[model samples]
Target chain A: MSDDFERNLREHLHSEAEETREFPRRLRGRIRDGIAPRTRARMAPQLALAGALVLVAVAVLVVRNPHVIFTDVPSTIKSIFQQPTPSPTPQPFTCTDRSGGTTGASSQLSTIRTAPHDGYDRIVFEFSGQIPSYDLSRQDSATFVRDASGQPVTLDGSVGIKLVFRNTDAASGVQADAKPALISVKEIAQIGNFERVLSYGIGLASSQCVRVLELSGPARLVVDVATTASASTTAAPTPLPTQPAATDLGQFSCLDHSGGVDSGSAMQLTHVRVAHQAGFDRIVFEFAPQPGATAHLPAYTLSRQASAKFIKDPSGQPVTMRGSAGLRVVFHGASGATSYSESRDQTPNLPVVQEVAQLGDFEAVLSWGAGLSRASCLRTLELSNPTRLVIDVQTP
Target chain B: MLMDPTLGRVIERWRDGDRDAFEEVVDRYGLQLLRTARLILRDQALAEDAIQETFLKAWQRIGSLRDEDPGPWLTRIAMNESISTYRRRHRFQALTERFGRLGGGKVEVSTEARLDLAQALDRLTAEQRAAVALHYYQDLSVEDTARLLKVPVDTMKSRLKTALRRLRELTGSDEALA
Candidate 1:
């Protein structure tokens, strides 16, 4: 390589390096005080023995008198034990409108603010008057629609929470059209109607548990969404389920019954694509319309298989896929009348999914297999209109 | 390579257990280590981890290093750590696959220039990538680069030759290499 090439490469790499802000300062302190890795390795056995002893003691106590363990345990120990395992399950949060009807007086939504906390992000909607009675519900996608015009309102996240406030308007102290205050809350669409209800759609990065709180002085409605699975909490009295089994279907376990199957026409699988996201790898199947078709969404089953092999059409030969682990997705209500042209999409460098293959559309029970680098947490979403079946496998 | 007298004293003091001296070493070499690791690993967070582990190891074994200047030694450690991290992470993913579990930066360049270089760099093997990083970015001579990589000088020369050829092909910059 010439000196020019070397110099250019150096300049190129240097330009891409992130700004060296506090790294040197921060690393300097850590190096000064940090324990040596070898020392840590040397101490491992002793630490393991100590840990085992404590676990043994705790088990014996629980067997001897379980109630005593809970009652006499230190708060710190209790908190540690109570710290919820980060599961993708949505925690239940419900706040009913206490005010029977609109108070006849309208309140203006003044300012929107967002702040990040330890495990959650908060969005506060400040109002000029009394906090309005509202209804909030989670949706598969956060696109808010104008109730009057029925046009879809675009928001930032795949998942959303719709907030509808009664006898409120955005016209008073704030702009009628205002963007969301935070990245997680994609957009705050103001649906000001003459009747009484003022609605806003809150978009989120992904599905998260939302907690609604009402505060006074200058009245405000605050929503807190867990930024991470572990950060999720519920103000409701229901105790969470114990840690799920290793193979438990996490976020995909819940059934979204909102869009009923169109029973009239057969659904045609049109296109398939795969992409990697921040926390998961996604496979999308697009479905096309059949005239007078009432689409039926069959109860699909997702399972991991030992090998990435599928029985080929007509030949009866097994086709091997690119990954070590194979995910078989069988859509029950699909029509086999229109056979899909088999295609394989490869994403070799991704952490989870490696390849996605259209195994067979035999008998309209559309089946596809995804070759994953490893077994992963899998979730599915069925979107309507230009129907799409989305499967997201979370990277560990 | 020229040695900094001040950095040389700091290395001696660090070996003698002066914590402030270690800080000086970090201040001087931390960014360079980070840049080299980032080039090798192609991920900012992973690069940071490799550099951190490298420095920690350097601190632990500071007494054993007899070199008057610590730059090359530190760079070698950082390079090894980055490559190790890349392999270890991929190995963990492969292991988890058998059990059927799915688990799983900076530049001053114009965004486009940096992106073009990053994409081109991704095509090289890890050995080639490391050799280029140390030789070009760190300005180590071919002999020193070979020594740091623990390969023959001719082997280092071949690696650089192939890496630059591949990069030029990818970026369509034959003239730049010429």
Candidate 2:
């Protein structure tokens, strides 16, 4: 390594360090206000009594066993005084069960980092364990529903994003709610922590393009939302239909939007996500990579049918679902047999889309049927980076 | 180490419930701690926040201080707080790790001097940056840096060595090696 380079680094640090010379006025006042409580707590007699008892115990132990004084005194004293050090050994990582499975699988969310940049505001969530898988969706309104309590949480701002983090301990050292002091970001609050699923809601002044990414080297989930200036430039993964509901257009026909190049191995299906917006409901079929295979989506198709009946792929066994109408969704060259672990059948009974059932998971073809209340116009989108297929069903 | 009699007097008064007596120590070391935190965090506001937290912690434990000179103890707290803040904001906007290379991050360069070293230091990973800051700015020994960062001494040395290699490459000074 270059000595000049090291020299310059040292010089730069020292010179730059001189910029701030004094504590701010606010800090001094905070210190003055804080002194009283600490001083009072220090003067409490309980601690002195405890200290005396501990000394007496040590005396008796040493008298009873003199060899411990020579061999273990330093270690015993150190253990009592010092902070407990975390074990250096790492725990084996298993996928956090989506249905609120094992506590051993859950990781603590240690810190939340946020900032506003030229075109986007970023939020990075730091976790003690591996960065947990998450579900991200844009909501039509800032009205959030708490997970377990089913209480209504009205947040600030016009539009919002709802995030559900799976296998996270909600009891971690994080703020219950915060206004993230960013340029365009307005508010963020923990909606609930139910069964190891921790949910947070981010409210923004208006709708914006957003993206979520998983980063390693101290596992973090990065959420970036476009600011007003950069909204036009930041390309969304896929655009959702935001026009007024067109029940007049009537036909729930969908052109085949899900065919793609398949690699050596089929995509591994992971989680199934659902969200509700104004006039529409959406289901996201998210996938993770089968080892040695790239993260990708398979060829998929969505079609509307009159009856809530579907035949299992290859098996041809008909499965009946709820609702007056039905939607058949199929992904070719994909199988959920190995990767997908979440519940296969879901009964989320929303306004337009009521239930979803796994029609088949055989011979490299994974299929699901969406039970709809009525025939509705729907849209499909393909997104990457933890590849997902999005199906949005419009309400009549 | 011989205790400074004057510093001893100050510690005693502070232990006896004089608020300004502790604030006096803040006056002596506040700038240095801020500078150390600033080097690690790269954001002056966050550095100030770290220093404030350090001072508050020191205030709480000041009475039980085993020694007169509080420099090393205060620096240790500041290092922990700065590293904690750094882990949270590595790819943040106020000071990015020159994230343009990291795909989703952006770095804004203001001054020539800052651009030179900030870009070079940003090339180091968070662990490397902490190693360098503790070893260089806070003047901690490699063993102490390892102990504070909770790594083996050899690991600390490796991180510092890797950090220097990265800095050398960023500076285009590839002439020397050990």
Candidate 3:
């Protein structure tokens, strides 16, 4: 090529590069505009309704919403009850500590107590609850307990109570149920030093509500003695409030006990727990007061692109939503009392909250309910602190 | 129901007037927009401002967007705003030049032999310089260059050809060409 031609082309290209500057300007503008949120806020109610329905269906098909009460027995257990073993229906036996099969007699609720037994805090119950006389090999749990004392009876100094059923040989004719069992814990009265009622609004399956009746060291344990209810009748048992739906925003990791627990499903807040995950979100505000401290909100409210939601206390109390736009929730308590909030929508601030002084070293799931779908409990906090308030919100 | 199409529809509806739709939009795109702005602006604070402004403008003029291509449109607006900022500074430079006060000199191009070429380029009209930049560095077609500048196709070609001729004479590169 001629030198003049090559030089001319080079000059031409150089000029071209210069014009490209405008291209960047234009491209930049477009990119900027693209990032902006659309102004149209008009969703057709039908569309929303449709979306809600689709979400509901997806949730239903994906996994049962933990909140919705399923009248039918869970499919997992349906088949076991469907096929029966051939034979005459065995009479109910009342023998204790006997490993009987499908025909084992059901025991009635007898007496319940919490003593420092076996070197651990033991919430023992004498089962007189009705059950099949022979062993019902299929898995089923049938014991219930609660902190009827209004205050949560710490389980061997642990956050949760453990029910250990001992099948000591009872008098003759007293039968023992087999394999799977149900246990429930309900709080009834106030006891000990912990002020903010621990298990105030907790719900347990009627069947599981028999194991350890955590009374306020004084409530009565009325063992509802009845004939053995048919296996078919009790086959489809209801779950405790802790069960959550499939699509619920599963879990989060909060920094401390003050973390929030929430769900897009918008269900009633039942339980909450702090868990560990890859990253963090915001904290949650529990309406229930802290167990034993005067409620003083932390000094700083976290700010970020994410958000936080204030959930209702399991006891169904309204929590205070403070901060810039009701984003920060605060639950005022009586002097020297405490409350909790699971970190939902984010990983809550750990060291900031007052109660998380001790490294509780436990993660939990927070659950809630919505009109269309039951929200799944999520783990929104890392137990980066001790003495963390690990709430277990059950889906409604 | 499939949600992707419905999400688009929801956005369209939100643009219509349901006040709560604004929040939905914010919830849906807040992080995404923040990210886009950050990529474009580089400065975190500036990116935030850009995103905020982008949303503001979208809210204000969303009614104009009748087509489904909201993304490119929005991005264009943001780019224009940023460029407008650049233009303002450029205007200041022009003002300074009018007073015979030179602003910051251009970064000297790499090759000294190219220095004369660069100075010669400095001497060319801004339109000619832009044509060269787009054609050579940006690798745009003459047709695209014209469309971008809103000039005729032939005009772009002529400007390019003229720039080459000038460079050839200034550099005395006929021997190299042979």
Among all candidates shown, the one with the greatest lDDT = 2
lDDT of 2 at A112: 79
lDDT of each: 0.66, 0.70, 0.36
> On residues B13-110, what C-alpha lDDT tens digit does candidate 2 reach at each position?
77787776777677567777787778777787788778878888888887667864677778778888888777777647325455555676433333
Looking at model 1, residue A290 earns an lDDT score of: 70
For candidate 3, write residues B1-178 as lDDT tens digits: 1235545655567577644444445434444444433332333445445555666677778788664635445544554444343345357644554454255443233333553554565544445555665565445678876765567999888988877765655555433555
Which regions in candidate 2 have their CA more than 4 angstroms from the true location? Answer: A36-396, B90-115, B147-150, B175-178
Isolated chain B TM-score per model: 0.78, 0.75, 0.46
Ten contiguous residues with the weakest lDDT in model 1 chain B: B102-111
Of 1 and 3, the candidate ahead on lDDT is 1
**CA shift of A85, model 1, Å:** 29
Least accurate stretch of 10 residues (summed lDDT) in model 3 chain B?
B35-44
Count of clashes in candidate 3? 148
Over A233-322, each residue of candidate 3 has an lDDT whose tens digit, in order, gives 221223233223422544321111133332111112222333322222223332222445333322211211111223332222222221
The C-alpha stretches of model 1 lying farther than 4 A from their native spots are A1-7, A18-26, A36-396, B1-5, B91-115, B174-178
* lDDT for each residue of candidate 1 in A1-396, tens digit (9 for 90 to 100): 356665778888666664443254334434544532346579999999999999999999999998878786877687887996453343343321112212334787778777877667778888888887565666666666786788887776776777777667765555445454553555555654545567777778766666666777678877877676655443211222323442343454221213335243457777778887766777877777677655545446665555666544312335687777678776655654464554544554577788776665554456677887765545677777777777777665
lDDT at A128 for candidate 3?
42
